[model samples]
Target: MDEQGDPMPGATVKVKGNEGNGVLIGTVTGPDGKFSLNVPDRKVMLEVSFVGYVSRLIAASDTVSLKKVVLKEELKNIEEVVVTGYQRIDRKLFTGAAAVIKAEDAMVEGAIDVSRMLQGKAAGVQIQNVSGTFGASPKMRVRGASSINGNQKPLWVVDGLVLEDVVEVSADDLSSGDSETLISSAIAGLNADDIESFQILKDASATALYGARAMNGVVVI
Candidate 1:
């Protein structure tokens, strides 16, 4: 359904689960704006996307069946406020390589964590889902790696509090098993429901405010 309660057609429906690692099933809505997908019995995320509207994510359980869904049309020219290091500024006045993802926009279907929400959303930002274990977080690099010996992960700040990157992986862990043991990111502790928005700073112009600490990049939440 559309925001006006009218039936919509041609909307995309995708299902993702651990078995698929990504999209397991993809289909389009019928002429009456109804869709039925046969997904695996395991836990999955259902993504509904339509052009000119905001996409919605719905988590699915074994017994879950979607009865109704609505898509809201996009609003243009709405000013957005973003956090740039120590200050909040209007997005129009900011001049730098940065991207902002609101909570609604970040919540994609099949996303297990916040880092997964950022995959391919930002231009210079790269997100690699290296681990499939429970409670694991993906590896993120901003504007590529800058230092050989230093940490390559982006700095994460939640509600003005800087978070520490605690990823540690031994070389032996990679070669010894079919599935490499990946260290979870400290940001994995955050609750996705509590996050309002996230701003990623990619270039020096946007990250200089944090100095050396943001050499890799900055993810301000």
Candidate 2:
């Protein structure tokens, strides 16, 4: 039975002897939350347990007619941290196309940097290798370039602050792999342990928050 006087079916009733180790003598309660067990002619222990409720231990008399028991419900609340943008908002309240990748989930065994680890981590976001070299900074694009001679990188934001400092690489620089191949991404300076998650916002909602600078999209870390 529960604390509310309601019958709790399927509760386990065990007739454990003096030593309660390796004993499997137990039975589940009936529909009316009642159980009967046959034990030796000696004082033993009765262990009552149920899921989502506290377990109870009672002394079983050497005679018959055992006492009734009641169980109590256990309630719990959980808060999961999954950042999406500048502020935390419920999924039902936010109308944006966003993908969040946890640092622990995106870590690769032999990945040299965070940029390669982010490859294929989000939808409609491309993280391509600028060169075949191991230390070359990868190119990331949320969408196709809007202009031929304009800034083509996605907007970078770290903890609600826009980061304007970035190494600009032209198409020719990428082909020859000489000018910016050794230059690391701005995110490379950040400690991977300090990074919680990467949130990529890819729609009008991104531009609405940062204006034309976010026309390409937003990468919030």
The candidate that wins on lDDT is: 1
Worst 10 residues of 2 by lDDT: 77-86
Candidate 2 lDDT over residue span 113-209, tens digit each: 6667788777778887767776666777887666787767788788888876456666557657784555635565666677787878887667768
Q: How many residue pairs clash in each candidate?
A: 0, 0
Worst 10 residues of 1 by lDDT: 171-180
Q: With candidate 1 superimposed using the best TM-score fit, by how many Å does residue 147's alpha carbon deviate from the native?
A: 3.4
For the record, the alpha-carbon RMSD of candidate 1 to the native fold, in angstroms, is: 19.5
Which stretches of candidate 1 lie above 4 Å from their native place? 1-78, 167-183
RMSD of 2: 11.6
Each model's TM-score? 0.56, 0.57
Per-residue lDDT tens digits for candidate 1, residues 125-208, read 888765456656666788686766656777788877788755454323323333324344657667788888889988777555
Report the C-alpha displacement of residue 159, candidate 1, in angstroms. 0.8
Task: Choose the strongest candidate by TM-score.
Answer: 2
State how far residue 130 of model 2 sits from its true place (Å): 2.2
37 Cα displacement, candidate 2 (Å) = 54
